[model samples]
Target: MLSNPSFLVAWVFKARYFPHDEILNSKKGSSPSYAWRSIHNSLDELRKGTRWRVGNGRRIHICEDKWLPTPTTYKVTSPPTDFEDFPMVASLIDPDTRWWKANTIRSLFLPFKASTILKISLSYNLPEDRLIWVGNKKGIFTVKSAYYIACNLVDTVEGACMNGLPTMLNLTTRGVNSSGFCPLCDKAIENLPHALLHCDHAKQTWSLWQDCSVNLVSLILDPIDIALNLLEKGTINDLEIFFTEFKGACTSFSLHQNPSATSWRPPPLGFFKINVDGAATEDSGNSSIGVIIHDSHDTAIAALNKVLLAPYTIEVTEALALLHGALFALEMEASYAIFESDALSLIQSINSGVVGGEIGHIL
Candidate 1:
């Protein structure tokens, strides 16, 4: 059954052949033994060995060929106990089998034993620090899974398990349960659609951009399929918007989850970094806005400067610094300049294009 693809099909057909509750409860001992004994008696004819037929019973044969056809099966059974069994198993399997050449299959089997080690380490509450070195005799798969499981890390979102981390399968850890919540909104926890499309707040935001033309409700009904469709069509802009919406929804959810229910801060559009240093004691609020432009490298390409108007509030000082920098960039005939500030709200307000607020007037 393990060797055949057809066995899974047969499993569906034979699912009702046994009484499920009875099969689940029956054991070799502890309970009344009649049910198990009857099952034992029914299979008594094959007790001698599957290799031979005695009495009027069915017969079965055990050969590696029955499981694998064409090439005679190879055997390398005498591997050292400490070694991983896969290398030997792979060596035994037909060298020409398509699975043998695939990198995906190789990766899948390499961790067969590592997963066991991770579970053991996690069970005993071992220290959580340190990268799990693969193939180290000191480590196990179970412990590695535990370390990953605790952090809720996953490889690329659509992984069975994180590359070296554990998965939801490690249910032994605490505070995890099987509930479907929108990755965006957690309030009336349900499916992705409910959180991203059906949520009143989310719907309003999406409607603002899409104008109800995108069939968001239906798309949300099968977000995964819609997502794949977008990808396959190479609709990069739509995908970006979907991701942005999804992130917004999640942030909104996280905020509501807190006891005080603070509202979410929308993600910043861009940053303008402005660094200012001045000494107030020496009348050296001779502040200068040092504007440096670099092309993604720490090396400076251009440096420009301006004097400041205020030095009291580092807030006021930075505004003057940016104003000077902005005017300088304009004078130098540069198209745009990213203004940065240590004060978050000020930078955020400007980046968001919400000028005419208090900080806007001050600057």
Candidate 2:
């Protein structure tokens, strides 16, 4: 509650010390306590999920502030005739009716953008604007959701293996399991390669699975070893088939569960469609990208979700997603794949070859 004076810490500072400013706008005072100064470190993390929940809209800036629910640029992208004219979002509202001035919005912005503004329902008795979390569907934050996000953002495979993704061998070594044998099958010691590849249950699953490229189970090499070999050999098709098969198998292996909503569509008779999307919190460096591949038959061949180490403008994130999508398609041997993204500016720039911003380098 950095912006709210109701919280104990915020109230104390507001009442006695920084009466005129909140934590977000206030500076570290002269010779501040170590604990007070340390709070600055987490302010970036806090800003990532914060967005103004429009009420009277007096507190939000029309172009500079994040009040809209839309992605990419949360603020208005359609340049105003004069930035100073509508500096505050309140200027665009019908103060007496406590509703948006619809015609004013239309004249002020592009038609599509005006529609977005119109869709925002207004309250009869307009209240003060307050910050809300956009991490979940509901505008509330929960530790359960936050923890889930943190765990998935692990940067290293070894670190991920140590976290929640453990094989029977890992459990046994940690004294969590009596023997290394998989609980599902007593066939052999269950290391990652064995449970996911050589186990009889895994073998049956792969034998019946629809792969875009290769029948990895039929190969003499271990499944994990084959993936490693493909990376070394620089062969795309076999690499694609191997991972596609494994990604499908991972659902049964109980790796990561994705909760993001997706709409499905089949590609052309001989092509695959690779749909890509990127997410970022405003002013928060935390960003992630996702790619999902579907074959002509509408079967999901493979999917990947990754958190980027460096944050970029949403445009660059989409460009990065496109880049990753192309690489993933190449790895899977989908030479006839089509890339799809929500960033219209990026796509238009790609076609024109007159790119701008950080995404230009990625393209």
Candidate 3:
């Protein structure tokens, strides 16, 4: 039910379960069920992760509606008294060229925000406004995503426990116990920082995960400070991997054992492997493409790096890089070459012999 916008709008309006022609049209009504009322009250939270994809922009008010990428509505520190009378978003766009008026937007909004708004391309013929669910990659809401979001918002205690922080250490400090000795390490008190960073097992685990070299025990004095630093700078994937490995290493040490190391294998003989990758900057829309050709022995034969023009999505950039890599291999006159890319969607599309979506032409 959460995944279907038309159904949700009907539900919110207390209309019949059947489809309605004016579902997207603005109307106010009420639902008698307490559960539905509760859900209706929480719609504001859902709106935070949703944005309007500008089309004709006729229905969207410049200052009231949120069409910008930023979370906040379009606003300025100080404005003219008649700012409320400013025209719809369509006014800022030139109908003849179907492009945003650069000078007008610059005068109305901050320079950075104005530039971001300009980069978004409108259709040659104006289309209807689209409400995109930014919470999911496909721009559609799901109960699973909503559940996770709710859990994140309401389960603070569970979050701290899962992070391996020692919340019970305060009991020992209040004279509830003689000492807060660590269960895993008998040498030090079982404080949050000590268990996660300063313990002997933690030190060994940190050494094994050599990519991140921060010595939290030495550099950070308070556990809260360390948490803040990590929260501010850490990537979700990096933090998850770090904690999983750290806990596994600690458990192995507790059992007086060592974890086995992983080994890398080379490609099969008689085939040349070509690896291609691409990266795009969100702020500037600039992209870079890279490709490398390696033999069965895992020795590099050729490499190329090229900077591409602005205004390309990450998927499009990756597809372009793959095409360039294949062309490069053809130029080298290589036989039985194996192309590889990190994008599984591109690989699947190529294997299926079906090209679709915005980058369909390029593929």
Candidate 4:
């Protein structure tokens, strides 16, 4: 820690001016140099996450004018070979002159603090465009590896906070059966490319997929190949959009239509996504409304605290349910609302303000 002049200066001597020896080594039971060594070790050990016994208490006495400049600037006429020469030059200068000189030089290097050192180490690990240089007795080191380690640590922390299940693996293919033909569409199982691109379904999706695949070929291939193909290549962004659309199509094709799926509803727009659901039981003379409001991230922001009173008309309850969600959002400081309903006619009625019919009047 004392290797740098700034740190030494900050600790043992005051700046702008020098400090006297009496003040620098004022503690009763220890030498001034010993006290400085102890402090420096204590600081260094802290960085390494180590603890040590501190013998002397934290009090030191020094001359009153600690930060004053040295009396003689030209005292050190030449660089002397031994450490003993420092004191001779220091004595010729000011009482705390040596400490100030040490610290002033120390500032040119990075600080001894752990955070500062870690930052310096990480800067070297980045790409040349992003890398930072740290100078020491050794040549400069890049901080890329340090940055990767820091990123890994941050990712671990974020992963812990997610509190969700691992993502499901995507199935891209079905292997050939005993007959040596594709299981998905009865085509020959020749090669991976043939299996992916030559199938009947694959043929239907290829024209669009090919246009998108051009963008990502470089990242999938080598830098040399990409450089050679630059003039004829499509951009990476285009492939990304194509992949997203293709994935959505695959998911859509995977779903099986069923009687229970008839009630499935699409999502809403705006800040709050209001879902309106109504139920009625004529035998029990009961009708209830449920309204759920979600944000753009699909998190439940608010719900109608109070359910609608019983025996209400189902259509009226549905309208009230949507209104209840809106009012709840308003109370929660929502500026925009998007109301969704499976009842398309009812939604149209509300938007159109159709006043004559049964559902229209209720909406």
Candidate 5:
């Protein structure tokens, strides 16, 4: 349980001691078994191992967790000024995008390590940090989903993991013989936002969607931003359906498709990220609002949930929920922040500088 903590084995030991903490934070009891102490020594070695399976990054330390992917301590040669400032790898991640903080990493570590860090593709589904046995070249003991996701990452452009199918523009950069424009409609240069969103074929495909046709009109943002809007405006099930349909559309567009493959990128460094959402009961004319504030370290600074007595449209409720959260943040003096919501229409209105409807004053 202590050494290979997974599922039930890890839970039992954790419950016994350090229930609210990690195995790394546990101490040997007064009369501990030989197994307990043995695991402690192994944990120390893994901490200094060459590669650790990255998850939410709440457990591993930055400098002291030298057993980075390279495993050769030479990767991150730059000495850390202080270990206390960033005790865990969580500080290295951006909570908003759920990806690594590139700027902060480049500023902190050497080029070799920083490059490795950036190449490490994160996942859209935020999972817990896991382990891959030392000397396991094939990552046999690692999470299967993450390994598959890593393979998919290769299909994406250098920076965007959710760029769908590479357009003629990217193909030309790779020395393929073709005009760098849309094949279906030769009017514009084909990029990620254009290939899957702005293209005439893509537009027609999305037009077929029934439940959320409004999203079809609001396809001005990148896929990642669009995903965030969907999550805030709709539910997980809704997002799943959208992605499934989107994948179909991309596949029909081209065989070289990389659809619904997403990675968590953290919000910008030194910025707090707030995720706001609302749910309403049509029968009761009541709604509930949820707001959570997290710093760059992925630590929740504050969180709140409120029940509204009156009924309101989904858009208005989401806007009100965001307003409530923003006010809460201001009360606590969290100025530099990136607010996130699933309400695409509300966000579009705010971004276009054309606030309207009931939430115009709030915007």
Candidate 6:
């Protein structure tokens, strides 16, 4: 609703039924109703993540409003006070060329900030300021994103520490009768970090799950920090697997139990495993399909690669690849073969024998 220019204009100028502009733009001289006050309070929270996309920038204030790409409003060591009228962001742009006045911006703002502001490309065709949700990729706001923002704001390390799950060291500090040594590894003190990440048992569990040695010292001090770093550095599938394995490892450790050993086993003596994969180029809309068949001894018996005519959705391409792989396996005179694909949804649909969707026909 806030993104609609017509709605905003009406609220600001039309006062026959509502005084939205007066209430929003100016402080209430007198006490407002409870509902009005509640709305005003919510607006304060909303303002934190909201920023303006520069168009003509006529409506954006130079110093007070959050028009910059950075999180804070524009500031300087010394502010000018002799001007007759406060400057708008439009004043910084060249009227003739419709480009930022580089020299003027450099003199007015900090060097880095001036460069950032100058990088903002403005279109003369779009003359209205656009409200953008800085928290989202598309600059559009949603209640789901707002809920997550609120959760992050409310969550704190202190709150987590006070949730009654005290470590052995914490219990000892509080005069509880307990051994301060780690239960898993008696060599180290049983602090939170030691129990979760540094103990020999914990390290072994992590190594088993991650298929690599665990280095406690290399990890972030806080789990939240590690999670945020992983979110930035890893893919969604990586995070999902990490969380699932970590949870199981922690549960097993708490129970003082070791994880059972498991190894990949090849298909039955007579059967072969056909692994199929699909790739699509997002820019060119081109796709390719590949398949490789391995016998019981895990030796590649046959392989095939075919360039698809046109790009298709990932699910469709994967289904097509699986179909091609099955045909290739039959052509090679394989009586019993297991089709495997990384596309879980396609595999599940094939197993269920219920294929009815966008890519269902391919299956």
* Winning model by lDDT: 2
Ranking by TM-score: 3, 2, 6, 5, 4, 1
Candidate 4 structure lDDT: 0.37
What count of clashes does model 2 give?
A: 1
- The CA root-mean-square deviation of candidate 6, after full C-alpha superposition on the true structure, stands at 18.4
Alpha-carbon lDDT of model 5: 0.62
Count clashing residue pairs per candidate: 22, 1, 0, 24, 14, 0
**TM-score of model 4 vs. true structure:** 0.25
Sequence-dependent TM-score of model 5: 0.33
| Between candidates 2 and 4, the TM-score winner | 2
C-alpha TM-score for every candidate: 0.22, 0.40, 0.41, 0.25, 0.33, 0.37
Q: Can you write out model 2's per-residue Cα lDDT over 1-363, one digit (the tens) per residue?
A: 533448787776656446775455667778767876787666665566556777788888887777775532356645345746557989988987666887888887766567667756444457667676555533456666555434432323334334334677888788884788877889788777777777777777656433323455666556546667777764564455455445434432121225436665688999999999987655435568999999998899999999864444465566778877888888999989888887776777778764322223355
lDDT of candidate 2 at residue 166, scale 0 to 100 = 69
The parts of candidate 6 lying over 4 Å away from their true place are 5-35, 72-86, 147-363
Residue runs of model 5 more than 4 Å from their true location after superposition: 2-9, 17-21, 34-51, 82-87, 138-363
Instruction: Write candidate 3's Cα lDDT for 1-363 as tens digits.
Output: 334445655565445422353233323344446654565566676765556667788877666565664322323212322435546878888889767887887776655456667755465456766666654444556677566544532354344444444333755666575567877778877676677667877666455443443455356444445445656676554444444433332331111123225343446898888888887764555678999988899999899998764455667677879877987888877677988887777888878764423333345
How accurate locally, in lDDT, is each candidate? 0.36, 0.65, 0.60, 0.37, 0.62, 0.61
Instruction: Give the worst 10-residue stretch by lDDT in candidate 4.
Output: 52-61
For residues 1-363, write the lDDT of model 6, one tens digit per residue: 354536864564334324554223545335666655566667666776676677776878776676664432222212343323747888887878766887887777655456557645455343666656655544556787676555532343334434334668878889998888876668977776666667777665454333222233456355455556566776554444444333323331121223326444578899998989887654445568999998999899899999765455465577779878988998999889988777776777779864433233456
Name the candidate, 3 or 6, with the larger lDDT value.
6
Candidate 1 has an lDDT of 0.36
Worst 10 residues of 3 by lDDT: 251-260
- Residue 344 error, candidate 5, Å: 39
lDDT of candidate 4 over 1-363, digit per residue (tens): 212235865654433223442222333333446545565444422222211111110121112111111111101111222333232222221233211233432332223211111111111111111111111111122255334433542453343234221211112223322454556676465333333345565555444334443443223332224334543565554433333332222221111212234453434555566776766554335456677777777687666645443344455555556655666667778777777766555677667654233222123
After best superposition, candidate 3 residue 19: deviation in angstroms?
Answer: 12
